[model samples]
Target: MTASSWLLVAFPALGALILLLAGKRAKAWGHLLGCATVTLAFVYGVILFFAADTKSTVDTKLFSWIPVSALQVDFGLRIDALSLTFVLLITGVGMLIHFYSIGYMENDEGRYRFFAYLNLFVASMLVLVLGNSFVTLYLGWEGVGLASYLLIGWYQGRNSAATAAKKAFLMNRVGDVGLALAIFIMFKYSGSTGYAQVFDAVAAGKFPPAAITAMAILLLLGACGKSGQFPLQAWLPDAMEGPTPVSALIHAATMVTAGVYLVARSREIFNATEDGRLIVTLVGTVTLLLGCVVGCAYDDIKKVLAYSTVSQIGYMMLAVGLGPVAYALGIMHLVAHGFFKAGLFLGAGSVMHGMNDEVDMRKFGGLRRKMPITYVTFGLGYLALIGIPPLSGFFTKDAIIEAALGQGGWRGWVMGGAALLGAGLTAFYMTRLMVMTFHGKERWKDLKSEDGRDFHPHESKPIMWVPMAILAVGSIGAGAFFALGHRFTEWLAPSVGETVEAHHLPVEAWVISVAAVVISLLGVLIAWLVFRRDVPVERPERVSFVTKAARKDLYGNALNEAVVARPGTWLARALVYVDNRGVDGAVNGLAAALGGGSGRLRRLQTGFVRSYALSMLGGTFLLLVALLLVRFS
Candidate 1:
């Protein structure tokens, strides 16, 4: 089993390498390799989950990675319930996405490169979850960031894709700095960066209040970057430039969740610091509202989902902010969101595939008749996302809300209210999307020529539908894992013993559950009333100011341009000017001065015979005078 655990990391990486070597000539082989590798990884995750001892961390040291007098690090794997859960998600959901990519990316010329990056992403994510030490984890962390940049810019010919990829990379680099600083602080304070050792030291309360606050804040910054929170969130929506499968994997299942996982893994430090917890809660609340607002305005199908990813990440952050019970709530929401969100992205892909690459929902209408399977599957996922009753999102979302309300005070209430409002907005935008894309009159007049030959949109192939169906089932039933909450808590008890009690709540859990359902329904009603009315759709110029604001994402992008981009560009230009004039000019002046002096010295070397004789006579006279003076002395 220990050997098998290593296989989990090796398989996808091996697959990626093979695909890279084979390149475009082996496109089919690339997909096959990617699917096979992740499938084996998912099976290994299932085996490890059941076989490993749940009560403690199962650390398997393969070798010593770093050895120093002051610091020692080992290459090892950690297979606890928490790690196992994420492993299953990354490999299992990742494999499904890989299979879906075969059909979705079939028309593209660079299919092999696409699958190669996907395989690499899977391998890096597994390394991230399985790593037992901070060093190993950071390796995986940066690896995923690299892969994200590569995949997002896969369509390098498109300027938007290249720009989006750069944005994602640069933003994540900011978070990476915070994470690196936190790791250093942990090693300095706790004497080790191993999860078990550092956590144990933290639980023992060896660090001061200030140190604890700094560590938590730094880790939170990393989380903010990876999870798309607050100011750092500007990159995610632009990340819609990538292929749908890439978006589904990075935004939904794997990379973004790294932040939530980091905070949860470091719960001990956070639980000890009030300021830290407050920061987490505040950031989460802000991101949730921001994402929801922006999501409501976008008509582009993938951009809407991208913003929703930001919003859902906020919900998870809220769970972490609430403390211990929120951790489980966050994890539960994480699992459920993974299913529905991935399903939603793939469904969008199916629509794009059927419409011959059309993604603007405004350009689509009456697609339900043509793409019935996609409509049904996507609708199911959307319901789950909106927190509709009996779906996976409802149960998990309510738990987080309950934890927030029960946790006490005005902050909790404010965050809880914001979360609920976000939920309502989620339904509104998603419904708007569904109606405009699938429920209206046919918008595409080019579907047929003037002769009126059939040019109808067709259903997606079985490969695409299979993953959507699997994810749809998970979206409906994933909330059942909440029933095993006690078992999960027990398994993680040793690592989080002291803070585990912080998760326990005595309030009426059903109250929040009921409220969430009612609110979701209300959102659906509002969407229907506004978008599904008999009145014709108004032009943008004719709409109200508020509607226009919502349509333009509340001018969020404009705000970002003003606040982030303008200043950054000005600063960069200023530095360039200073370097050219101040630094380079100074160095060039020094070189010119030395050359001038050397030129004067060169004149004395005149090669003429008369000049040489005069110099020799002068030299002889000087030598004779010096000898006479020395002799007299």
Candidate 2:
């Protein structure tokens, strides 16, 4: 909370540097070091959490980073309730994942290297949340991106992993463009990217509505990229190609949450315009539906979870985008999601570990008896995820739904219905996942490991299951605790700004809450009936149009290729042609003409004295003839 709070990031960053630099020498001790750094960070984060006041914000200038003629960007940290909340989530979840990784990745030769990347990511994310200026935030933003690329492609031996990494990097680049432009816009109008200065300027009515709206849209584009919203969202599910721990920490818990944090952090600019919030709501609605449908088609355990993550982020976006009453609701969901999602992912990893590192849920069955701890933890997480009453998801997700419906008129009906439907689909897909993975006939009995040995499914060790258990506890309690007296919303107000009061919903609060529970249970019951006892090992070729489309990522890739990627390719080719034919041709043609002329002119410079004398006599005769003609004329 004081000057020393900088060490929260410094510790992990230094740990990563030393481990990477020491190479083989540090390999044996590197995992321990990595865990220690994050643990220390979490400790400091907790300390700062208690020390930080809900009513105040502090800005600490570390040093002058950029001092130019028209701009000054200082490297400083912003310590406030909102940033602290994110910091705690990042470091706390990061620590648990790091510990879990020690057990899961123990045998890999690159275990130390994995730890290094993990530590680096923690440090980068910390900086991103704590930064006081846009430039500083961007520095951390890019750092997180680079680390994600490295982690997601951890299995470099596989072409798919490499491709997935590139996809993530490139798609994020598409989003990063929006974030960069937003920053430029802020700087252009306000002459500063410092949070306090720009926000103050905005509050003072300095910028016009159009300009503020533009900034909001651009920032939302950036959010869509990082948070895995529509159009820019195809990358996040693909990010599962990395280690499961990476999925738990980066994709599920920390890094993907960056977009929500960004929007919440810059709420002032967004508050200036209604269009900005509406756009956010639209993107969230579409993405949640997209993720929900896609999730139903994936048999890969991790891919299902990946798509689920996409869906959940959509909910968060929808909540925040609703504006005012929903900002706190969005963050509340985000924090609760951090717990259950991490637990679910780690539980998935445990499932994989037991079945010889397999990811196909169709090949798994009756794992409940074998992995008790994992089953219990995953079950709690599942309940939380389904938004069952009293669990985290219920309290947080219900608030968003109620708020959306509270909008009234057609917008409320449309947005609220989308959220409500997404909830049912969420339950349906997740329940389907649970049934296929845990309750069905033992499909693994007939399968063999990649090494051709009989599969013997078993539970992970204490180190792994312990963290999941803790997270499961969080999954159960976090939402209820935050929902109590709206404690979390009040805590975050000083930093995230106040919510405007909105009209109540047409339905009663109890009715809305009851409807959510009923819808979720219906989905679960249907899935139980459909998938509890039977599953197909081979995927069906002929199915419904919805199935086919969902299996193809709802044709998002095709759309991108048709709409964005192909057009981009054509534009690039056109630019290349211009460079070659127009620009280069002009220079090349002039050079060729000069060369040819010089070659022809060289023939006239013969160096013979006799030839020169003859030429001189011929010249003298010609001169006399000219003089005589001139005289006569």
Candidate 3:
């Protein structure tokens, strides 16, 4: 049955193809078909999860992809602990998101098309995890980008949706260059692109330290783009312009986590260079604070959650960046995040569904009476996100916090401090969201949407609530299930190696956990104190500089425009100027000179007998003079 792993990708790919080919005709059953495909894949993945053991990695070859004497690349599936873990996460959460979409998109006319795009997205993500070679992974990598572009731009009539999709595509392309170059380096050095061959070569010191470090850095670049870390993070919040299910799936469950998977998979290369690991850790730390600071200033509910994801993934990046000691910790947080974050996004969707699609938290108040199920589920997720005990976030995230502090020395102090502060800010913003949305006065009573729609909040359908309920449970319990007795780290040991701390701890683990929980609760308390009163419908203009900066994503977009976009534009224009003035000028000048000389010479050919005789006489006289001079000499 493990040999039949091809069926995993085939099911969803086939679903997408059918939906596309069937077109409008598939509307009757397209969503059902889409859900069925992912459900089947999830069921199969569960079977494989139970059947596979810790130390065994099964490589099932599909065919000879690029057969050559100089290089060989086989298309194959790698059924290992790492790949299998991602497969289950992608398919399992993907199945729930699909079901939620069926109800969320019930009224939209293009629901069928949306499901097709979802299936394609899932299929691409599955291949990204399952592929045995970097080249194969690139194929799925591009596929996921395309599918995301399609889905994010699904509401083509909306200018924001179109622009957001373009922004996401362009930003991801910047990172993809790094991935492609890294693969080229791998092929040039190892003469193969397969994971086993490349990892083995790195292990045997076949590649130089420069090459290893370069690969590690380039891979991190790719991860940064896909995972929305640091500089490339501006696109993530904009992506919420798509459907909420798209937000839940792409941001929370599958696509954003691809970077963590990449870093974890290439553990050998990073271990070869201290600089590479430190850079990853630094990027994670910077982005963690960036996301937390910005998340605090958002009035839009979805954008708040989006920035929260940026910060949480930063924790995962930080954990993996710690090397063997915390690779499993990173992945464990990733899984737990998938649960609570997806629940939060779906809960946001539920809020929008009930509140006539208002996204500004300032416009929402006293909605718990109208949306009890959504409130309960979203509150649980919020608790999990704020690191309340017994919840998944408390377990998974606290482990990363402890690991960061365990790095020892000034490095530990810096990163661990950032992680702790991020937890506090996360609670503040999330609590601000919860209070503004579900408590306080009923702000929506007097408000009318831009579309002139009055707010009438109600519970979402069972289809939507059921998925949120299940995820809420996971949000509450997945951390304990994965972290208790070191189950998660040990399970991942076969893929990432043993979790051995290289540095001594600065303080006890319990000390770090206690500090984190206290800071988190303090954040929640401050938000409540501030927002438990009335929230004005319009944002105040007389805010501090920090508030203004946070509202603008800390000016990340402006910096990119100045540093990358404007410079690139000027360079392109300069190339065009040179092409026209220099290259075209020379060629055009030569042609004009030839044309003028021919025009002057044509006057001598007057097309008459006298003109012909005079030209012949001149040519003869010149030839005779030249011959006489040579003979005399």
Candidate 4:
């Protein structure tokens, strides 16, 4: 029965292969088949999740993927707490998103292809999590990257979608390089890429601190790229160019957090290196703020939600970065965040469906009544996201905050303050989104679509709202279920390592928790009060500097262009110039000199017998003169 776990990936991969090869011939039923693949995977994942316990780990080899001298990489699936958790999340949320897309993309001509791509995305993520070696993981990692590029650019005719897809692919490539290099480092140092072997080697102190830190940082780079952390995060918001269900599937529940999974899974490397752990903490702290500030300035509902995903993922990263102390917390937040964020994205999709696909929240007002189902489900997700009590966010996020403050010094203060600040900003932006989108004055009296059809926003169909409703329930109940007795964290202990309570807390846990709640409520209150009605749908030219900067993603794009992109471009040009002028110049110059000398020397090949005789006479006369001079001397 456990061996049947291979079916988890096979089902979806086969679905993708069939739909892709069938092309237009299978359009009508392919979408249904695609949905079935993931549904079956989810069912299998559930079975595995329950059957497996803390110590239950099964590594089943399918075939020998790479078997070289002293280097063996197997195409193996690891069934354990860590991989199984991701499998369930990927497949379960995936199945719901697939079902929802049936309605979301019903009118699109390429709906079958879209489902096929989505299935492949899930299959690839499962491969990534279940992989037994770094090589196997890289295989799945690249697969997910390819599948996502396809999904993000599903609207082949749209230039924005095409550009977004390219951006996603290029940015992710940067991370893939990091992952590849890290694997190389592991093989160089440990002589094996298998997780158990690498972990054992490291535990036996086979590697130096520098090597550990280098590998950790390299892996961090990969995480940053996939998870949309700083420096490599600019592409995520633009990912909204894809369909809403894609946003829900890839951004929220699955692909974006592959980095988190990588870090969490590679916990031993990070734990052994102090600077590496702190670096992870710093990246998470900074990116969370970047995400929050950016989220507040976006009027595009999808972009706002996109930034929200960025910020939430930061919380997870921060938790994992807390080293062994909060690995479970990170996983907990990740699971809870998955529920609420997916619901939020799907709910946003519902809003788009009702409002003729208009994304600007300023154009959406009094929609709470018009789209009651969306409002209710989205509202629950909203509360959960903002960390309201009894919701998933509160349970999972508060644990992270409390853990941060528990670090017991200025370190705790700095990281905790950053987390708290991000939380407040999150609430503010999300409340602004809710108010402007659902509770403000009617702003759609003259709204029109691209086709010039008048917009009369209405509720989404049952197919769409049903999934949103289910996810909403998860967002509501997941926190309590997971956090009540520390059940989820305890369950995750065998994999992430047991989290001993942080006894070195700088402040009382209750005090920190209270501040978090108050700060969140404060943000929510101010946003609702400030933006209860009449938002400017059109871009304002005279906004303040913060708004301006944030609207441009806090000049993150410009900064990257100046610091990374521009410098990199100039360096590439310089390298090309040097290669052509310095290296190639020498070779070409030598070749030219040889050619010129040969051309002049070739003139001496005058083939006439008279020329030959004249040369011989000159040589004979010079020889006699030299002979006479030598004799006289």
Candidate 2 residue-wise lDDT, 158-197, digit = tens:
9999999999888888889999998998888889999999
Q: After superposition, how far is residue 633 of candidate 4 from its true place, in Å?
A: 8.1
**lDDT for each residue of candidate 4 in 105-128, tens digit (9 for 90 to 100):** 999888888888998899899889
Ranking by lDDT: 3, 2, 4, 1
Top-lDDT structure, candidate number:
3
Off by over 4 Å in 3: 501-503, 618-633
Q: On residues 217-255, what C-alpha lDDT tens digit does candidate 3 reach at each position?
A: 999999999999988999999999999999999977678
Residue 541 error, candidate 2, Å: 1.0
Error of 2 at 16 (Å): 1.1
TM-score of each: 0.90, 0.97, 0.97, 0.96
The runs of at least 3 residues in candidate 1 whose Cα sits more than 4 Å from the true structure, single-residue gaps closed, are: 445-455, 481-508, 534-539, 542-565, 604-633
Which consecutive 10 residues in model 2 have the weakest lDDT in total? 495-504
Model 1: per-residue Cα lDDT over 1-633, one tens digit each: 764689898989998998899887776577787888889888888887788776677899999989898799999998777888788899889989999999998888888888889989989988888899888999999999999999999889999999999989998998999999999999998898998888788888878889999999999999988888886888888888999899999877789999999888788889889899989989998898888877777778999998899999999998888776567778878988899999999999998877766667766778899999999889989988998867888877876777777665687578778887888888888888888888867776445422454345789999999999999989877756555456544555555442343322335667666777778788888888876643233345676777688676667667767887788899999999999888998998899899999999999998899999999999999999999999999
User: Against the true structure, candidate 2 has what lDDT?
Assistant: 0.90
- The TM-score that candidate 1 achieves is 0.90
lDDT of each model, Cα atoms only?
Answer: 0.84, 0.90, 0.92, 0.89
Error of model 1, residue 630, in angstroms: 26
* Candidate 4 C-alpha error for residue 132, in Å: 1.7
Question: Could you tell me how far off, in angstroms, the CA of residue 487 lies in candidate 1 after the best superposition?
Answer: 5.3
lDDT at 594 for candidate 2? 99
